[model samples]
Target chain A: SQKIEQNSEALNIQEGKTATLTCNYTNYSPAYLQWYRQDPGRGPVFLLLIRENEKEKRKERLKVTFDTTLKQSLFHITASQPADSATYLCAPGAHGNNRLAFGKGNQVVVIP
Target chain B: EPEVTQTPSHQVTQMGQEVILRCVPISNHLYFYWYRQILGQKVEFLVSFYNNEISEKSEIFDDQFSVERPDGSNFTLKIRSTKLEDSAMYFCASSEAVDYGYTFGSGTRLTVV
Candidate 1:
């Protein structure tokens, strides 16, 4: 069976430190991988997308790295603040499949 | 910015009662989808619609669940007989293409009593 796994334990970090999250998948080769940020009772907001051919993508303070060889992706938030605290989700999709396979998501809390 | 709109932010229905959830996807999007997330669980795909028909569906999308593009702009999901296990947050999403990121609606919280 195909599975996407993220760290279920909540990650606590001090403010101004870098926060890193990992996503690992098995039995699937997706054409693209995406990251989303979701708050309580709200739908996910798109953050960034990295294609199979691309190794890394950065937008402002957020950066994503994809390693197809390892079937894993890493999401990083630089200069993290309390405002960056939220649940982050990883979604991987195949070339023709319109639907995305999402992981359980990892929760991050930046403490002051 | 454009968004996918869902009706009835929250719905409380009796078990075995039929309920319809409505959504209005972004105007220019070509693909529509329905996803559900049980409290504290991962988002699960229900069905995907394109070109006036279902392009794909997950195992969770059973015969009791149906989706329809009633009009050019509106999409709907109907549950024939609601069950306690069916209570979840149903999200509607749309995208311009299969590979593009989807814009999701605020979601409707369905609580089956």
Candidate 2:
């Protein structure tokens, strides 16, 4: 069976600092991994997707690195702001499957 | 931007009753999916639909649950007999392709009393 593990502890960081979150998985070699941001009482919003062959992908202040060898991925938000405070989820999926295996998101709080 | 839409943001139903949750996926999306998040838990995949048929479903989607694309635009999930444990937030999502990112609806919070 496949399993995904994310930090259960909430990540608190000051404004303008960089926040990094970790996602570790086992028993599966997903073709790609995705990150999503979910606000309270709302559905998740897509953030970024990184493929297994890619080492890193960036969009504005967000950066994601995938390490297939370790079966882990790191999501980074630079110059974090209070608006960036939310629960972030990681999902890993196979190449042809429409379903995704999601992790228990890690809550991030950016204090101003 | 086109978005996936779900109706009845919250639903409270009695145990053993039937409930139908509705969703309208993005117009051009080819793949549709249903996922649920129990309170304080990770989102779990329920089922995936394409070409008017179910392509895959998880064990959590047992005989009690069924999905249908009754029309060209509307997709629905029907719970034949809701249980107290059926309380959760059900989300509908769609994507152009499996590899592409999905757009999820606001979700319908189901509470079985």
Over the stretch A5-48, how does candidate 2's per-residue lDDT look in tens digits? 99999999999999999999999899999999999888999999
**lDDT at position B23, candidate 1:** 98
The TM-score of candidate 1's chain A against the true chain A comes to 0.99
| Per-residue lDDT over B1-113 for candidate 2, one digit per residue giving the tens place of the 0 to 100 score | 89999998999999999999999999999999999999999899999999999999999999999999998899999999999999999999999999889899999999999
lDDT of 1 at A81: 99
Report every candidate's CA lDDT.
Answer: 0.95, 0.96
In order of appearance, the predictions have TM-scores of: 0.98, 0.99
Clashing pairs in 2: none
- The deviation in Å at residue B53 for candidate 2 is 0.9
Each prediction's RMSD to truth? 0.7, 0.6
